[model samples]
Target: MNQVWLRVAQLEDADAIAQLVNRAFQVERFFIEGDRINPGAVRELLRKGKFLLAEQSGALAGCVYLEPHGDRCYLGLLSVDPGRQRSGLGTLLMGAAEEDCRAAGARGIDLQIVSLRTELPGYYRRLGYEENGTAPFPASAQPKQPCYFIRMSKELG
Candidate 1:
């Protein structure tokens, strides 16, 4: 991979980001995917200053949404374009999200990963994230998913 840059996700990137998010994780039978969030929602996130995008040479590569809550930030809807996977784009997005949280005075950043993705937890662990506990992916709140969830956290040091 070449040099990458982080920027605020714009509404215009919503379709591209939606395709990336759905294409990346929609195949898993353990969870029924949610409708790709509306571009308006992405715009709102941008307005609230909660979203970030990763790019290389002006191409959208990856993204993560951070919801600040006091000293902790909730990370959600993280994704990297399949065409750009295995190239450290995910790490770049995570790093940028953490920085965003820290800049907002967050003490820690956390995410909920589908517990059934056996390899996913290890991936986050390698990035210095730890399993904080297990949580339910409420079929109602979550997208009709059968998978359990695990909360993971990385301290902002």
Candidate 2:
């Protein structure tokens, strides 16, 4: 594996970030929309929060978006390159995101996973996140089937 490093994404990274996210989320093929994200959407997200990117040998490998809200930070759009999945990069990104939130003075970190992705809740649970509740899926998502968000949170000590 190449030397991996994390950094805050700049506006210039929107295109690469979108490509990486869309590729990683291609598993969402069951949804009404085939692609998980677009550069325009990524650009929009950049306006609201920061994106942490993981690069390997100068190639974008993974990323997660963080938006601070009062005592909590909302983490979302986590994506690892399809070729790099199962290599523990996701776990590293999760840890980094939590530490970033903690360093920002957040008391907790929050995230939402698509309810349809049955495997995700357990994954986050293993990372110390607990499901708090469910929220209606975003209208923009246009899910093909009934879908909602599984809200999860992890307290930072």
Best by TM-score: 2
lDDT against true structure, model 1: 0.78
* Per-residue accuracy of model 2 over 19-132 as CA lDDT, tens digit each: 998898988878757777788888889998999999998899999999989888999999999999889888999999998998999999999988899989988999999999
**How far does residue 18 in candidate 2 sit from its true spot (Å)?**
0.6
lDDT of 1 by residue, 1-157 (tens): 8899888866678777766666666545455656556666676776655668888888777888888777789898887877888998898888888777888889998888876678889899998999989987776756553678899999997
Give the Cα-based TM-score of candidate 2 against the true structure. 0.94
| C-alpha local distance difference test of each model | 0.78, 0.91
Provide the TM-score for each candidate, comma-separated.
Answer: 0.84, 0.94
Which residue pairs in candidate 1 have backbone atoms (N, alpha carbon, C) closer than 3 angstroms, thus clashing? none
**Residue ranges of candidate 2 with Cα displaced over 4 Å:** none
What is the TM-score of candidate 1? 0.84
